[model samples]
Target: MVFEPDRLPVPAPVIMIVEPYGGSIRQQNPNLPMVFWDDAALTRGDGIFETLLIREGRICNLERHGARFKASAALLGLPEPILADWEKATHMALEAWFSHPHAGEASCTWTLSRGRASTGLASGWLVVQPISAEKIRQREQGVSVMTSSRGYTVEDYLPGIDVATGEAKGKIPKNPAPWMTVGAKTLAYAANMAALRYANANGFDDVIFTDGERVLEGATSTVVSFKGDKLRTPTPGGDILPGTTQAALFEYASAKGWRCKARELSLDHLYGADSVWLVSSVRIATRVTKLDGQKLPKPNNEKEIRALINKALG
Candidate 1:
């Protein structure tokens, strides 16, 4: 469905159902179903997923993205994802989607959904589609941003912390509601949508969430900045997804004789940085021009930073 830019109510596009659990797609394949989601994955958000760009039929950072996806599933007490011949499945999905007449030139995503099983974890599927290149272009020119106050700090439930007894005990917490899959790219994405809505209502393009006073990440991307010669991002301690683009920046920056580190970041530091940008699989790298009501100065080394990102993506 086509949505007008000035419409009051945003329209949810008709998501094409390429595959469904126990559906005809499964019967036809005879192998594993193309996509499957069990009751647990659908109802309880008990699975993990990943989205990556496909350029010229090649999935970007496939190995790294897959490793993170599997790790997140395990963290949520879900069954380990089957990796056998998964790369071939991902490529097939991308090729099919890109063949569409309206497919654009850049920015696509492959999503994997794990189905719920009666006794085990669940089944899974891979979905591939082209994303809007215009959206990426607009972000590249810089976008207005606001802060969301609805998410929790990753530190609240560190990997080793216990939630049942309200003590830092032996085991990790068991599926905390609301932010259960904060680190996982699960299908349950209401909070992220709410933050986006908040941004729209306030005449902003996007929102960055915080856990109390600590800056976590944007609803859809990783927060990155350049402070002098140092490239900094929030460490993937617990509260944020470990973005592959963010990881790539570290390697790229260091090779160019620049310092890169992951540490706890504060709002003031983000606001006061020499340059601030959001990185993700789609956008790759884009600057943040305004935060709240304040306009930030353009980075002195914008060209250098952009070069670093392009090199990394290649």
Candidate 2:
């Protein structure tokens, strides 16, 4: 017999279905961890999702997150996701989530799976829950990292630049590989999960996937470094998922007289940089204090930086 994710009844986190595969848009009860056994989301992990932060009943960067969500769904060959439906659903969850007196920072997540396991019908829903303590800890205290090879070269991605011509050749490769789902935030995250597991097993807080010496990105975050007056991150048009937080932060930095740059970063460059950070939407900004057991320089104005990022994120 197929079972649900519960033995006792639970009541929290409102769920809304906007075009439920073959079903119409509607709201579900906020009490049970309900899921039919035939959900592809669990069976094959054929889905796309986004986790967003909601503070004091307001979603942080809802527009950007929604846009990315639609983009991800498109990458997965799923139907168009109505941004208005998501926003409407989010408001419903937010209302139920903050209805409690002890409410704090809440996380709102929406998942769009290929469809039902048996029927192949599209399925999607949104849920709101409290943020984890570890995320909060990473925000309060910085994190450590270990570099691991993601088994893909940087050039394997952005193959646009003509070596001899040295001119704009365009973005997509003339001949692309089957498994090269570089930037699509698909649900097939086994590699990402494995990388983080390896890091934790080795006493590290997170893993930054690198192509030998060429830095790529973190398992669930993006890497950025600061030196002198410039803030640098891995270049776009690569295997790296374009970081929403990184983009926003760069814009914020530029407005405040900080020069932001994007390029192919080397491990040596990152190690020698004055300050390094692992940034993401949910974790926000976590300064990298140690890499491979070697302590790195901590920013003197950490408090100021944190404040600035929080303000930017907000």
Q: 1-314, model 1: which lDDT tens digit per residue?
A: 89754343322211222232232221123233433444555666655667777665567767778777766666565556555445555555555555664444344333344544664535555545445645666556987888877554444455422321124322454654433434556666777888888898879988888876678888889999898898898866455666888887788779888899988899899888998888888767778889987898898788878888877766
C-alpha lDDT values of all predictions:
0.65, 0.76
Q: In candidate 2, what are the lDDT values of residues 242-297, reduced to their tens digit?
A: 77788788888889988898888998998899889998878888999899889999
Clashes by residue pair, model 1: 37-115, 38-115, 38-116, 115-122, 115-123, 154-239
| Candidate 2 Cα deviation (angstroms), residue 102 | 0.5
Which residue pairs collide, candidate 2? 21-122, 38-117, 115-121
User: Against the true structure, whose lDDT is highest?
Assistant: 2
Instruction: Output the lDDT of residue 156, model 2.
Output: 37
